[model samples]
Target: MSERAYGEELMSEKILFVDDDINILQAYKRQLRKQFDLHTAQGPEEALKLIADHHNFAVVVSDFSMPGMNGVEFLSEVKKISPNSVRIMLTGFANATNAINAVNEGNIFRFLAKPCAPEQLALSLHASIDQYHLITAEKELLEKTLSGSIKVMSQILSLVNPVAFSSTSRIKSYIKHMVETLNLPGKWRYELAAMLCELGYVTLPPETTSKILANQPLSSNEQTLFDAHPTVSASMLDHIPRLEEVAEMVRRQQSNFSDYTLTEESILADPSTLGGCMLKVALDFDRLINTGMSLPKAIQSMSNRRGVYYPRLLQCMESLSKVDRSMEIRPIYMKDLTVGMIADEDILTVNHMLLIAKGQEVNLPMLERLRSFAKTTHIIEPCRMRIP
Candidate 1:
């Protein structure tokens, strides 16, 4: 096949046609089968079931006049279930008001009169498929570009202030576990925020960062700067594409749950603030652990703070701690090291200078550097990593 044909085939070829009338569905199958991979449903309910089973459909066409659910209503549900799928409304009794309502409320891509010719329908389907591809492509491109920029920024921060960034890898691990435990969507943003949360520390004096990481008491001025880091990080990330939500979460990471009068129910209702709560809990837990508190003691300390951390978040951490203890840690040579593996303990040079910290997730660059370093300076043989 040609490139364009192959691309189209790889993209979503499935188109769903929903109508109460059997004859109309049969006509659609006969007319659309050659140009499109078609699926027909008798009503909106059956169409929804199909959508649930196979979540990808390039376009969904529904007749406006149906027995129980109108075309507008069905399309609106489709928008929620699969927002990327293009929607079209077909009605025998077309009115200006109905068309406007369908377009506005249901987000319908096209409003077709019942006597839509095969040619017109085909053109509409082709346009809808093109639109679906366009939306998905734009989203994928934006995510890739933003993620790459963030990763570079994080590496720079790591090099500039190793102490501040040392704990960040651990913070990211915690955030990952919390997100997975809760089965939250859009985990990339949370993980990204965790990785870059300490970006603002790059501006702090090296000695100040050292003190903070060592859990030494900071002077009033130093404390103020430390507290302001979240806002600074948020400001730095705010202008990046698709990072608005992540920035907001970072800005509110230090906020106490009791600071706001809003109940958990209210906060959970708004996804933006809920993300902040997650960040807050993760940071607090990391701080407690960094202070040399035992896992149980850290959980107890956060619990004693009452409204400082969400109760469910604390419980998730406690559960994760138990699971983490059971995880097997094994030693491997530097030559065998690979990406996506977490370092079980700090990897240091012969003089004991920290090269990679415990709980740090290894990447390609770090792996390459370790391999190069191993040739001259003897690293403690058999570097340990958790097999997760």
Candidate 2:
């Protein structure tokens, strides 16, 4: 709660978007409102009223150059109340200065230019969501999951950014909805496919999490890098062949979203699978909500998303996220003890192991006398040696 920068991704809980222009509001809703759970306001007063209701919008984006309240002033006030919610400024050339001031004094995230492209807006909002998740996770780590190192890593990763952990949950929700809504072939492969689609992101830079979540169009260089992420992810699990099929699914989630034709023998989509479409759209929707599309707007946009996603899959997403949306808790704890757990400090553990590996024993004097007679791999897994 000390407000230091975090190195993980965090997707906030909800979003609120405000603007004076009805057209802008409507355009945003048209683009992404249905894709996310959204709350919208036409002006500062209405926005303030919504905030007063304690809706806890994780990310708030406002247009600059409003009638009475400018973007900076309105957001400045918002920062005071929901100090945790990420504030973003959307401004034209005239309001650029004010937006920068907001970024400085208000501790706002990056500012966007007026008439912001849907992709860019979505990316920024996703970043805000990521930040929120990180802070929440850190707090949870302090409160709960500090006991075991493995548990702490899990809680920190999941709580800080549900995007990583929620990949499984979100895909599970998608499968349940798709199986019921689309009435397609239900297979464990589909379920497995959904869960592991984003495993590639584990090795990705935290900055790239927002970019991927936002579904922002990637540049040529970025696209190439992203294209290789699947391969990178697969390498991590190569030691466990039980997960190879799942790795294949993750690698192809984005690759199969094409108009190109495929043969029946091909793994690519033929007529198009609702399950496949849902994952991408859901991923995008999650980003849009983070970007600041009010819940209603996000839902509306997802509903209105024509050829971008299957109608049946979108319907399921709408039903699942809007109604009976369950929030999972992040657990953590702390304790002192023992060896074999992941060491917190690398220098101490690594150097000691290295010295032993180089034929220098330093544990018990008896062990040194024994090792003086024989030399081999000193440190072994399930290291059973405590003394000579």
Candidate 3:
């Protein structure tokens, strides 16, 4: 329920410059120092350390050819670590083909030739910072759009996968309790993450979605697809630009504690933020609780798993889940709409008489048409009257 005003942070008001060449790094640092917090990196490894250290960068201008990890590899890593930071590549010998490849592969911003002009670097940095601003601005816009989208999607998901939707919402409700119980981030990141986490289900078939709802174990392939759902959801939102970061946290939510994997490495996809840890914990609680496991059992299982999730979050989930579901969420309905009433929440502005017509997409247009039909039919309320 606690949603903060988003995007108070302007953009990459801070910049980090990376190159094996100390001179180049220092030169840019000197020129852009006043405008940006310029840091130097001798190599990709060093640059990553700087990212971990400062934990913030508006833009990164890195060399193409570096020991161990090249520019593309470096930015790919950066993308995992810092979803919002803009990246540009600096190269000397690479051809247009190579640069294009790097840009596509790395998801880079701009390219600067080797021994670049001072103005060019400044301009790129300026553009990158502006790009950061644009990026945040876009995410904010989508967040607004999706604010309503989540409520609608949750309702759709309820019909598609009722148990999953209810369970997920319960987990979210409990997570909210935990957050308030502990005074967690006084921001909307957790709420936003929870709202969009189930988005990947959009791509899931009703049958496949059913199995997950049935709370049955998935096949290896199904499990893999489920694991990759975060990326799928991220891809869907990535194009919108504004939901990039939320999409990111959503994508990595399944990085649960595995005996074979490291949560820090997997959950720490973005080293710049600790929300990954929070998300991992949230997912862990959902996985355990949705299995009908109790909080003590969940905690014990987690302990046995060697800290795949934060215990504090688990504690909160357990604590909240106990008193949580007591709140009966009142269902909002239009009077003309019956229990079996099927009105499009989309196309139709007004509620009208509509039955759940089979095979229809139930989108905006169909709903609009149904509303028009409702006024015409003028059926009595679906609620039966008491014995009189």
Candidate 3, backbone clash total: 10
Q: After superposition, how far is residue 96 of candidate 2 from its true place, in Å?
A: 86
What do the candidate models score in CA lDDT, each in turn?
Answer: 0.81, 0.56, 0.61
Instruction: Give the per-residue lDDT of model 1 (tens digit) for 255-324.
Output: 8888777886667545567677888888777766766687888888889998888777788898775433
Pull out the clashing pairs in model 3: 12-58, 80-269, 81-270, 138-242, 139-242, 230-251, 347-364, 348-368, 352-371, 353-374
List candidate 3 stretches off by more than 4 Å: 1-12, 52-56, 152-170, 173-264, 267-388
lDDT for model 1:
0.81
Best-performing candidate as measured by TM-score: 1
lDDT of 3 by residue, 63-107 (tens): 888888888899988887676889998888769886887777788
lDDT of 3 at 272: 14
For all predicted structures, in order, the TM-scores are 0.72, 0.35, 0.49
> Pairs clashing in candidate 1?
none
Number of clashing residue pairs, candidate 2: 34
As for TM-score, the candidate ahead, 1 or 2, is 1
**TM-score, structure 1 vs. true:** 0.72
CA lDDT, candidate 2, residue 301: 85
For model 2, how does the per-residue alpha-carbon lDDT over 93-171 read when each residue is reduced to its tens digit? 6465675688777787878877789888877876788787777577556434322332334334443344444334444
